[model samples]
Target: MERSFNINSPAEFESISLQIELKNINEFTREMNLNISWQALEPDFNASMKRFGKKVKIPGFRPGKIPRDRLLQQFQPNIEAQFMDDNIQKYYLNGLQEKELVPVNQAEISDVHFHFGEHFSFTAKFEVEPEIVLPKMKRKTLDVQRMKFISDQQDMDVAVDQLRKAHARIETVEDGAQEKDFILCDLQKLDDSGVPIIGKKFEKQLLKVGDGSFTDEQKEKLVGLKPGETARINLPDDREKTSSSPYELMVINVEREILPEVDTDFVKLVNPDLDSVEGFRDEVQNKIGENFDSRSQQSFERELTDAMITKVDPGAPPSMVDNYLSN
Candidate 1:
């Protein structure tokens, strides 16, 4: 692409000539070769000098009134460097606009060639979105099962229970462990002979009696186990083909979670505007419904993308993937 335009200024040296040669290195990658004539940049350099002159401070000379030659002698190198850096980025953007290309990643600029009185040239390589050709549909319409999320009273009860648990305090228990108790214990993996394995001990670990992974048998083993007592727990092991391994858990301390009473006071503590427990429950229900709706939408989008990808497998550019992973 080649174009010439005059700088929007009264003192014009000549028309600014800019040429961009775009090349497709691949379906999703492109390289741009840009060249700009010296006449195009001369007016900008003079304008830049005037802009810099207003801010330049010199000894024995008033600001913005210093001799052009004296100012250039002191700050010409710095000014030229800033000018080139700024214009290089500006020209690169211009090239993209001229070619109507949207890069998915930052361009890798190389082979920069510029001098004070000569033409400027540079090369930029960047990644672009790949063209996708969708396959013809086997059916007339897509068959997608839309999930309708309904928040019922049972769901609200569970959400309220979770809130109560979140605000629950831990209290040291004097009796035997219960199903919801947390026990601080030391676990040592045992061999077939019921002997502790060396270097297989974990200390100061808190084990919840009612953890989701705990089976009924495991809960039975944990229940009624008091401090200073040991329980043999058979846990599933992925490393062994035998499927399970035995571990001796020595209880150090038992703690119980004391849930707060859900009343007007608790509702006010949860949200200051709410004066009634019923209002707080309604807010919680609304939030739960919103969360379910968001999750359902995300699931639908993911399933739709997967179904489309099975037909149109448009691969992503490495640079785009790298950028996504880095972020």
Candidate 2:
């Protein structure tokens, strides 16, 4: 592969003409025939230098007092043929990046020309990503575990219990703490210097015993802790400690769970459109079935894509990858 770059700067424009050719190509390596031509860049460069020269200070010239000719000479390297070469490579690399292409061979440059006060032109020739030979994928029958959605009596009972809990009201208890009871506490952490850390204090921390959010060991330690009782839960040594450390929790009070009665009121709370418990139960069953079916379909599609990629096993060139990253 070979390319020629002709760069020129005119009175009104900066232009580049590129001519690229593929010298060799085969099944493993595809040669690219690229021609990159651009124009009207000189005036933009002149304008940019004019603006930059206003603030730039040069020897023997005060700020904004440098002549255009002097500035042009001083900053010519900054906006010369090499500048266009860099930009051309950028554009070429960007196009290849969009296609996720990897070139196997280095590009060859030839017939590079830069004529001052004339149009700019450049060309680059390089190897392109080889075409993948996709293997024919055969559709195969596979056994998949499928769940049939059916509204059963047990499912309805579980849903009804959840509804009752959602509508439940909290009640202050004068008695001792019990399992599944919520306790409001104040949590804090102090440094070795006895300075309290921010975000360590929780004035109204709610702790629920036997909840999956807490471990069995934590629940055991918290069990039977009464009002105004300060319980210090040790921080896990391996756990990540942030700004808050040396933790301690103070249980202020405990509240008993008062589950609401499962009636029309609970049913209405579960679904505003439902008037009765039976109607809410029916709606829940339908939604569950619909969600299950949607998830199953999505899983099947994902499996199909995985199988296709496995069969194809596409190969990529490392040089192309490096070129893509550099660009």
Candidate number with greatest lDDT: 1
Q: Report the number of clashing residue pairs per model.
A: 0, 18
* lDDT digits (tens) for residues 1-327 of candidate 1: 122222121222233457989899998999999998888877767666777788878889888888889867888876665556556666777777678888887778778776566787888888899889977787734656666676788888899999998888999887999998999999999999999999999999898887854548899899988889999997777745358889999999999999999998789878999999789988998899899999889888877777688668789999888878999
lDDT of 2 at 237: 38
Local accuracy by lDDT, each model: 0.80, 0.61
Q: Where does candidate 2 stray beyond 4 Å?
A: 1-17, 20-41, 58-65, 79-90, 93-172, 187-206, 211-218, 240-249, 255-261, 316-327
Report the C-alpha lDDT of model 2 over 175-207, residue by residue, as the tens digit.
766789988888787666656788667688887
Lowest summed lDDT window (length 10), candidate 1: 1-10
Root-mean-square deviation of every model: 9.5, 8.0
Residue 309 shift from truth in candidate 1, angstroms: 12
Please estimate how well model 2 matches the true structure, expressed as its whole-model Cα lDDT: 0.61
